[model samples]
Target: MISDHILLTLQVLPILPTLAATNLRQRISAFIHERTYQAPPDGHVKNVIVIGGSFGGYQAVKRLTKTLPTGYRVVLVEKNSHLNYVFAFPRFIVVKGHEQNAFIPYSGISKGALEGIFHHIQDTAMEVTERFVELKSGARLEYEYLVIATGSSSKLPSKVSSTESKYAQQELRGMQDKIRQAGRIAIVGGGAVGVQLVSDIKDFYPEKEVTLIHSRAQLLHSFGPRLRDLITETLTGMGVTLRLNARPDLSSETNTLKFWNGDEEMYDLIIPCTGQQPNSNIISTVSPASISKETSHILVKPTLQVMDDRYPYIFAFGDVAATGGPRMGRAAMFQADIVVDNIQQLIAGSRNLCVYKPKFWFEGAIKLTLGKNRVALYIQQENGQEILVDSNLGHEDGDVKSQWAFFGADAEELETRKI
Candidate 1:
């Protein structure tokens, strides 16, 4: 036993040197934060209110809390008990265990609120105004500065099940059960969600028949050809039937689909990933002028202030803002930073306001995970050329790992931790 123990220790020692540096770094970083940190209490009176605590809302509120002083009583209102990692919703619907990683609790948001700097309210905003907002619970909150970052929503499983955490999980379970039992699955739209849904199903159940129908000839139509072509190849290789340039006229009564090419098909499971609508209902009361009649997105000035110039204190961003840009996480954060900076300027009694200029396509950038161990990074060069770069991200088991670490909407310890 002694001889074996010595051999094992020697074998582990060689590997320990490699991991020791990384582990030591994480330990040192954690030690410092634990020594000095206090999380703001949950839910409080409103001086500055932020609605919709997702990517844009969370970033905006966190930045405000870190920057604003004692006089500012910041409040964050979110309908969901936990922040939902929407990008992982597709995989969660098609698999098990992944749902656990999608919803992150709000309790870990700030280390603990000194100086009335942070508060959270798990409530829905029924209506909004320049002065106050009415909650669904019939409670009204007054605010000096208001930020609407409610983002958008799609069908269940594609997003979250509901605002309630338990109910949402139950809904996800039901969807997962349906997916397991269904013989043939039909996913409409070649957007990211739809593509991910079909791929996830096919990846797990190669025997199951899966079809992806997109109105456009290409997948991820917003991106350039190379990326779309790569996705098409990946799906085709995965045994997915792609119906491009064929907008199927769906009949709920008959439960059948008729394509433009006169082909008809039926499926045991039908998932419509299209029609992601903004949760801009609050703006209807506060600033109807900010609502775009065509797109239904809230219109904001270059400074990200609401369409009403006079009501500079009220603002909107994230997916709700009509910035004519892609609704990616990075883009939302960009808008959030500008909004927070501009808010700081005004709060400091400074006349100069920062304007939000949309970045070029290359600067925005997004990665698409086609399947396990298959990903393509879409980027634009300075010369206005777009390219889909190859990736070595061997993500197995679930597609939500890296995203959870980066923007999973949970991880209180990691939220304030830097490494």
Candidate 2:
């Protein structure tokens, strides 16, 4: 044999080659194995995604996340940074004198603080595909369950301005300034919004002339004759001019409103508390079949799931969804409960889908502040009509405090999940 050093070197060289060959063979085997067995579907995890983060959307996301299991993911995609309380819009216009009270920052609901139960995506949704939603930023989110709670937007006069929330706030401020400067204000539309706004304005500025113009012959025609007469009488007593069956076509410049009616009365300001259109463009793009032909509202099954199988994973609620009942914030919250229940059932692999029954007998309460100490109350009846009730008490009097307490409880629940 050769010397000991030479003999060792030769043995080491042969072992190195053997090790390299073995490693190469293992790599090749793994590659072949990977190719032979395709990767499993990435849709394994159960995900619940909610689009929109306003009142109805926010409540839905909060309830769903609270009710969902630990492993399930809940994603809330919202374009706005804050939640605007639309119900308080009139109050902001009258007392608070600004729209700031309507907006609340959404950071109150943090993901890490909630143990990562929910994810907040701050972006506008562009398209909703069969299994994914494409964001405006080109990011795609895949969801097993989807909730579309996009609400409605106000349709104002062309001169009034656009729907930019900032612009809306500016417009409200302008209106407030005009209210202080002018002696007469005319409000068109006798719906809840119009009536509430007029009530608040008259309550604060009692001396100012407030005229309510309505196309209908009576106030709140939908609520029946007795209640309408009562409300009309109340307004008249409060020095509010009620012009029923008066259709005034509006023409506005920078400051004054000219009515097309024969009177041709010039108003210091004309506020159109007209109707609203559902923000259903995204739904239309995603599931056109799910929307009703007559009303742009989305049609959903009893389970709140979209009627089209293409979006069986998608569900809708709020004013935009046709739930076969009155579309109100309260009703949306009620439907959210059913949505939460059905989503949980789906995740638990249960075939049972819960039906969402509209509470026709549910009487919605209405409170309108007429002046510093005067207010009006209207409660719905079993026959789907609003009846005039007493409204002399403040928050501390009678059931007023209890009513506020209930509202606070629901608000706290909503606040706890803000993000």
* lDDT leader: 1
| Candidate 1 segments whose C-alpha is farther than 4 A from its true place | 1-46, 112-115, 250-254, 260-262, 397-419
Q: Write the per-residue lDDT of candidate 2 for residues 81-178, one digit (tens) a residue.
A: 55655665665566543354345556545421245456788888888887788899899988888898887767432112333456666766766677
Candidate 2 lDDT score at position 245: 78
On residues 228-302, what C-alpha lDDT tens digit does candidate 1 reach at each position? 887888899999999888788755655478777888888888888887788887879767877999888999888
lDDT of 2: 0.67
Local distance difference test scores for all models? 0.75, 0.67
Candidate 1, residue 414: how far the Cα is off, in Å: 12
Clashes in model 2: which pairs? 109-418, 203-370, 203-371
Tell me, what's the RMSD of every candidate? Answer: 9.5, 22.0
